[model samples]
Target chain A: MNILNGSAYPNNGVHLNKRHRKAKLFSMLCSLVTWLGVALLGVLLYQVSSDGFKWLDLQFLTSFPSRFPYKAGIKSALVGTLWLISMVAFIAIPIGVATALYLEELSGQGRMNRLIELNISNLAGVPSIVYGIIGLAVFVRGLALERSLVAGALTMSLLILPVIIIASREAIKSVPMSIRHAAFALGATRLQTARDHVLPASYSGILTGVILALSRAIGETAPLIMIGALTYVAFLPEGPMDSFTALPIQIYNWVSRPQQEFHQLAAGGIIVLLAVLLMMNTIAIVIRYKTERKYK
Target chain B: MTMGTFRLVKKDCINNRGTRWGESLIHCGLALCTLISIVTTFVIIAILAKESFGFFEEVSPVEFYFGTRWVPLLEPSSYGVLPLVWGTLSVTFGAALIAIPIGLASAIYLSEYASHRVRSIVKPLLELLAGIPTVVYGYFALTFITPLLKTVLPEIQVFNALSGAIVVGIMVLPMIATLSDNALRSVPDTLRQGAYALGATSYEVTTQVVVPAGLSGVMASFLLAISRAIGETMAVTLAVGATPNMSFTLLESIQTMTAYIVQISLGDTPAGGIAYQTLFAVAGFLFLITLLLNVLSQWFLNRYREVYD
Candidate 1:
């Protein structure tokens, strides 16, 4: 009986050891895969930075595009992207905030409210290319806007509207209910309480959401491409009605060309685009951090 | 004194009424905007339906569904959508295959094992991946990634689906990781504690318990990611050649449905022409697929939502 028990102890020890080894192996594999993704991202960033750094001067940024590769600049595309983002922010912020306030604060928990909420969530997931198609059929053809900056901006506004609404709703929801009740008890009306107390409290949060949404809109390429951002606009758009190119479209046009120089130009455009995106994202992060701290 | 008291009382009443009215007006205005957005959805559907119907009048629905060829620009101009659909599926499938493992693993590491400082740093870095524009991704796919692939695989085409799919997978990895992390985080800590008490390994608990419990949200993320892959335009358009051939090889060039729509849109496909109408028809199909996926995800989430007190 003693011999049998000792033999069983060794078997159990071996089994436990095997299990531990298996767990270690699994963890190591998971860590390796995660690291691989990070490595790939690093390689991509390195390639873009290295290939484009030579041409990323003030002259490359400010001058107008020329026929020759070396003389080409992204002046029009840069201005157009800025203009489009501004218009998108202008169009999206008010409506999105209003919708969020109504949904979160004013609207009763009813079927219609639920439907609206569901619709917005669903719309947020719809592939952006579908928006491009809608913009093509509705804005370009139906409204007769043609291939213009206004059309692109309008399309982008719609694309990012749901994002803004979702973010604003979260912001509005974060406001303590006790504050609303206190204002009401002090003979402050609903409108006054919401406007003065609630809106102020939520302003930073709402602004951060709006900025993030706008940043997303700025990076979008599908809808704008569908709306016909010109591939090679040599001059800046004179008006919203004028055809234009954004940075992404210009990068796409350059990359599609057969020449190595154009590829370098595409990389340069990417650096500029990344700078704008990073700046916008940083502002958003700062605002979000500040708002979170205020709430805390 | 009586007049002053009466005027003060009247002023207070008027102020209260005015505030109430203003609140009502704001609510009404917001409702009106929601109404407008809903109306816009309807309007888009109507336009797409009308145009697609016009397209169907010229071509049979059967041809659009299953016919093997897609020659919308040729003399015969067959409108078989199979090739385009096949191309779309191949690229999206390739992308999902690449994205799922990497994204899920990243989410697991971040949520289950990483320290607070590591998570704070890694999360934003992951998000930076999403912030990169699809066009830049397209550029990378076409210029950098393709050439790199060509070194090992000499048969790879200049504008192949593999490079586009890989870049798109990278672009979408953050989205998947973020959503999946949120899901995993939502799992009750008590459940994890129970697993630990049972002497299960951390990996075993994570894979068997936490991931399973969060499966619905994870599935929703995957569905959304697939929808994103399917609807991608510029990246695929720039990298995947405009050829609409139906093939499974990752090395061969392919054209997705969105790319085809973009190509025709770029050209002068006259309003009310078959080509123009075809864009709507294709879009209608795209719209239906994405809508179905979104609805299904919502349904799944609602059905399986974890109820915690």
Candidate 2:
């Protein structure tokens, strides 16, 4: 309040101050709520490290899971996740990007494209576990893929397709129309314009989106669980056709065990899982930084 | 025109003609890739329909939908799915109870109060929290949260819906916070300035002006987060018991639809049996519920969104 206005309206000072005080207090409460999330993360990190740090060793990385917690490791799960994600990447990226290109550059604003857009958004909202239901029915049962690594890969590809497509479409959309117009003016077809000019310009953005989405796929357990990936495995997956387990699956298996030591192993597995996720995210962030700076 | 220019133009037309045919074919192929998502949806519907058709043929739809008990593994199994539905709803409700206020408050702080430096650090860190695997959340719930709850609330079971709710709430917090933050931020600065010029306090501007403007987005986030909580599997499966108890008590063990499906997959439940069919049926219901919520959320976001350029 202005000093002259406050003097003219005597009680206004106390009332205005009260309102300001309430606003300050409310802002503080909001800040506290924000920090609550950080507190949760801190406590969780502390909990996992304290319980499982001793078990996170070289042997833990290399050895196969055993009935005994002392010998149990995430070896099979690690390799299996590697196999799954590689196939997922190999299968999903091209198809997803192609879909994004079709929708963003070619389809334009047609009714069909709108339907597809709406469908993808709906698909993105479908729970990961429901995708597992399809994976179970179509791949595991119908195709008789029998929980193979490739089966898991295909399932995950379908699950993440909507996300990848959405992200890539956003990336493609960010490539302004002027670039495409320039190419077209130079006698290039729409395809040529998109491929030679737009795609290259948006590559980093698409890569970041892909990495972030794949990182999400890494942490997903429900669909893999729904497809009946084998939890108990002594050996690693030999090939795409072999049965496989993943990081989340192994963590789930260990967690469900009644033993306290198994929970600890689960924590160890989580640390590894989170490390992989963050590593990918870090790559995405670095690429984003490089791209942002380049554009600037 | 000169013969040289005419010949060059002719060659260009031929090249364009050749590439145009190839381009259309490439376009169709890319279009097929886009159609794959639609195909996935149809395939999901078809598989659930074909498998669940048998179950519906055997058990009356009314009984399956309205029945309270859900004992698929045991002989003389009651096929009532209300228990599972109740379980899913109760956990989702409980999770919303924990997530909404905290999420809304955090979103306000993020969009309104936080400095750019704080946001730069906190936002990505919040995403990291969201990125954590559900299985790990399950483990945390089992190893940490349930035990901690037990210290004060001794009556709580080792595997109870309460802890399941807490973990699910944590799991979805980032989505609510991030989406609502975007919503609030999208409410243009002019509105806040107008309120401030009218002598409204910052809190009044935020709670009254900014929040009302972004209500649709906040509501959409809530819907999506609730849907996610319903569909969450490993955490609920691990944190909550497998007992399909119809009682809605948070302290007691109950099984969600997701947890029930996981239970079937884990057990030696004979494939192609009624029990297995029940998995499809339950999953079908889950698909519908989440699908409806997703569509509604999308509709709300598109319909009511204030596009301030």
Whole-model lDDT, model 1: 0.82
Among all candidates shown, the one with the greatest DockQ: 2
lDDT of 1 at B63: 91
lDDT tens digits, residues B96-130, model 2?
A: 99999999999999999999999999999898898
TM-score of each: 0.93, 0.94
Q: Interface RMSD in Å per candidate, to 1 decimal?
A: 7.8, 6.4
Kindly list the per-residue Cα lDDT of model 1 for residues B123-162, writing each as its tens digit: 8888888778888888888878899999999999999989
Residue pairs that clash (backbone atoms under 3 angstroms), model 1 = none
Can you tell me which runs of candidate 1 are displaced by over 4 Å?
A1-14, A293-296, B1-19
lDDT (10s digit) by residue, model 1, range A188-288: 86667778888888888899889888888878887887888888787888888999888887888788789999889889989998888899889888877
For each candidate, the alpha-carbon lDDT, in order, equals: 0.82, 0.87
Scored against the true structure, residue A188 in model 1 reaches a CA lDDT of 83
Give fnat (model 1).
Answer: 0.59
